[model samples]
Target: MKLVVRVKLLPTPLQAAALEATLHACNEAATWAASVAFENETRRPLELRKHTYAEIRERWGLGAQAAQHAIKKTCDAYTTLKANLRNGRYGRPSSRRHARASGKPVVFRPQAAQPYDDRMLSWQHQAHTVSIWTTAGRLKGVAFTGQAEQLEVLAAHRKGESDLLFRDGKWFLIATCEIPEGDLNTHPDGFLGVDLGIVNIAATSDGERHSGRRINRKREQDRKLRSKLQKKNTKSAKRRAKKHAGKEARRNKDINHKISRRIVAEAERTGRGIALETLTGIRERARLRKPQRTTLHSWPFAQLGSFIAYKAKKAGVPVVYVDPAYTSQECSQCHHTARGNRPSQAVFACRVCGFVDHADHNASHNIRQRGWMVWVCGAQSTAPELNLIA
Candidate 1:
């Protein structure tokens, strides 16, 4: 499995200036390269390099490695754009958003991230410093800091290109670390089904709930404050808004990390596999009122699921995705499915059996049952002899 370890870079004023210049130059070169690629209908990095390599090196005064990376990044941007278009992320081809996206060459931000390979960047883990290439010259002994665990991981497993990015008036490097996975737990005792929701955040079949009430309140407050700032529309207000940007996202991500860690640890301890809902196309499929729409759209259900998945992987615990279509409506006790099963937001009352339970808890049990069936079927399919007997 590949993980990213991001560390904050501390540089002298001179070093910062050089880095700033280098980033700007690389992005400028990339923007020009994109235009050339668009005009010639050439997006392949190798073929596009033939047209823009010499010019970028000479015009931007960038080193050979820097020039190559800039061109590659440009091609990568176009590739991503093309994929988005194919996926209809911008809507139909007749839509204005789609037309606007496909009509022009891609542009790079002034402080866009630039990739640095071994030749362009080297780290001194023990010394807590890095020697990186800059347009001015090669910078040596530039300090960097990160969490102790992350620093250790970077030192041990860091490989491939690192991206230097400037964000929120800070310099950072995102390094890719390729960590080997351990043996997977194929034979599990049972599946720990987890139900993801906007209110509860995550509810497991084991009756554990990680509440999101406090976080949702904070988000509402932030939204209100942001609305006021936008209405004010002053320079200072704008500055403050920019300063606070991503704060909510960071908080949500941290909370998700803690919740996922606990869930994975519990599953590993019990020798249980994790079962989650297959939430693909949820956004498009969901319908909600105006007020509820924001809450639903802003919810980080996918991030939580992904975190649980990767953490479970690292712990050698297996994970399965179950179809969640009527899990909330189906009675876990009687297997009766109907819209009336959920008499309230949080309560599940079966119409036929008169059995009652927490809505999420009942749903999780249904998910657990489905997960077990899927696992059994899959196991049988893998063994043809067992399949023939069945």
Candidate 2:
């Protein structure tokens, strides 16, 4: 398993300026490479790689490894664009069009984020400092601070490369740490079903609910603030608004992290596998009304699910995804499926069997049952009421 740990970097003024210059030069070189790669009549890796890092190194005055990383980044961007076009994930090749488009000449923005390989980046565990190669030369003794646990991961399993990012006037090193995967605990007593939604972030089959009310309220507040700031049409107001937006995102991300941790911990403690609903392309298919579209799109269902999955993997807990079709409308008690089964957003009532429960909770139960059926009876099984051993 691979995870990224971000640590703050404290650099002297000189080091900071040099780092900024190096990032700018690297980005410029990358833009040049990307334009050349896309404008070429034949778009092959062999033709692209022919451009070479030595050319960028000589032109940009960058370290050999830094130059190589910059060219690789350009190639990666082009490759992704090509792949997306091939997979139909996107329409047409935008890079070619952009390269030929008339304007100020489209170029990659120098966002002050650069990738550093092992040769360009090194950490000093005892001194709590990092040495990174810069255009001016190698800058040593750039201090960094992080949590003890994060530092431990960096010291023990940090590998390959790390990203140097400049954000909000601060420098950060995002280290990728590779952790060993543990044997999954598959023979569980039961499954902990989780239904993810907009109003409630998650509802467990065990009757525990993690509400999204507060998160929704905060999002609304931020939206209104942004609107008012945009109306002002002032630079300072726009800057402040951007800052608030970032803060709101960080807060929501932290909440998701906490909620996922709790959910995974509960499954681990109870010796149960976690079951979640498959929600691929849910937003595109939802066909929500204009007013509700923003709210639905803002829900962090994907982020929450990913967090739960990675955390569960680290804990050796099995996580499964059940088909989401009719999970909300299907009755957990009576097995009746109908749109009218859920008369209200929060109420679930089965007309045939007179079984009633919280709408989300009922959906969670159905999800758990479906997961069991999928796992035990095989995915082809359509009997939702099949008997299973606990």
Candidate 3:
């Protein structure tokens, strides 16, 4: 598995200017490339083939080498970008597209080697900035010095591995690292029955339920903040809008991590496979619940499920995604369907056999049954309730 860790990059005063310039340049290149792609598609009727690199440079009034380099860094990867768009895609392709030119610019494609000028100025973080052709040697820098961790490459070549993401006015570099694959049955755990819900988040068949306190509190907090911001007309309010939204997102992420960790740890301790819902069409279904749509959608079911799955994979624990159909309405003990079994959000009482139970607990039992059926029937198990083994 590849794990990406974002290390803080602290650049010197001069270095910061250069970094910002480079980022702008890259963004411009991306924007230009998008425009070029659209033009290429439009020009197809004129029997024009893709523009050559030389033609692109002259048309864009960019330096031969620089323009070529930008194309390499930007355009070639987005297959859907040019093709999916007609005339232009709805939103601004980028804030930097140039529409004044004709014909088409060459599509950008990254070469295996880093394309930049040598003798460019860069100061690596406390380490020597060494440049060599194609492949260069690097002595790894010291880790975690409390100071901002930064590396400046003056036209240096890299191993073609780093992925950069620009979002919310910041750039994140994802460096891939390999992790060893281990035995699936390396450690054994007992079974865990799970129940999924929008209101409560989820509950274990063992009577342990987790609250959706994070989302509830977030909505209330956002409501108050939005109300306050709406009343103001100043920079502080704008700053608050940006800052609070980011804070809210981070807070939500932290909560998800905690929830995932809890579930995974519980499964590990019990040494059992986890039973979760196959939340297919959940997003669509959430939309149908108009009144409580916010609450239903706010639940990070996908994130939690992902965490559980990956953790289970690493720890050799099995995970079963049981079918969620009728989990709440069907009686767990008798498998009898009734309108009165789950008459309300919290209450679950079976009308057919009078099996009174917590709604979540009843659903969890069915989830477990689904898993058992899978283990017994292998690939033939369609959902959470195969009965041959039980």
Report the alpha-carbon TM-score of model 2 versus the true structure: 0.90
Q: Model 3, stretches more than 4 Å misplaced?
A: 42-77, 80-160, 165-171, 186-190, 227-233, 287-291, 379-390
1 versus 3: better lDDT goes to: 1
Evaluated with lDDT, which candidate comes out highest? Answer: 1
- For candidate 3, the clash count comes to 9
Predictions in order: lDDT: 0.87, 0.79, 0.55
Candidates' TM-scores? 0.96, 0.90, 0.69
lDDT of 1 by residue, 323-362 (tens): 8899999998899999988888899999999999999999
Candidates in order: C-alpha RMSD to true structure? 5.7, 5.8, 9.3
Put down candidate 2 lDDT per residue, 1-390, tens digits, no spaces: 777888989999999998888878989988887777667632454565576566877888887677777767876776676565576564444565433442122267786478998899889989999889988989899999988988887899787678888887888888777776557875877789999888888999999999988888878888888899999979999888867757766777888889889998999999888888887877876755687789888776777787888788778887788888888899998799999998999999998999999999999999998777766753321111111000
TM-score ranking, high to low: 1, 2, 3
C-alpha-based local distance difference test score of model 3 = 0.55
Cα RMSD, model 2 = 5.8
lDDT for each residue of candidate 3 in 146-197, tens digit (9 for 90 to 100): 2132222211212224433334544334333333333564333445777766
Q: State which candidate has the highest TM-score.
A: 1
- TM-score: the better of candidates 2 and 3: 2
**Lowest summed-lDDT stretch of 10 residues in model 3?**
381-390
lDDT of 2: 0.79
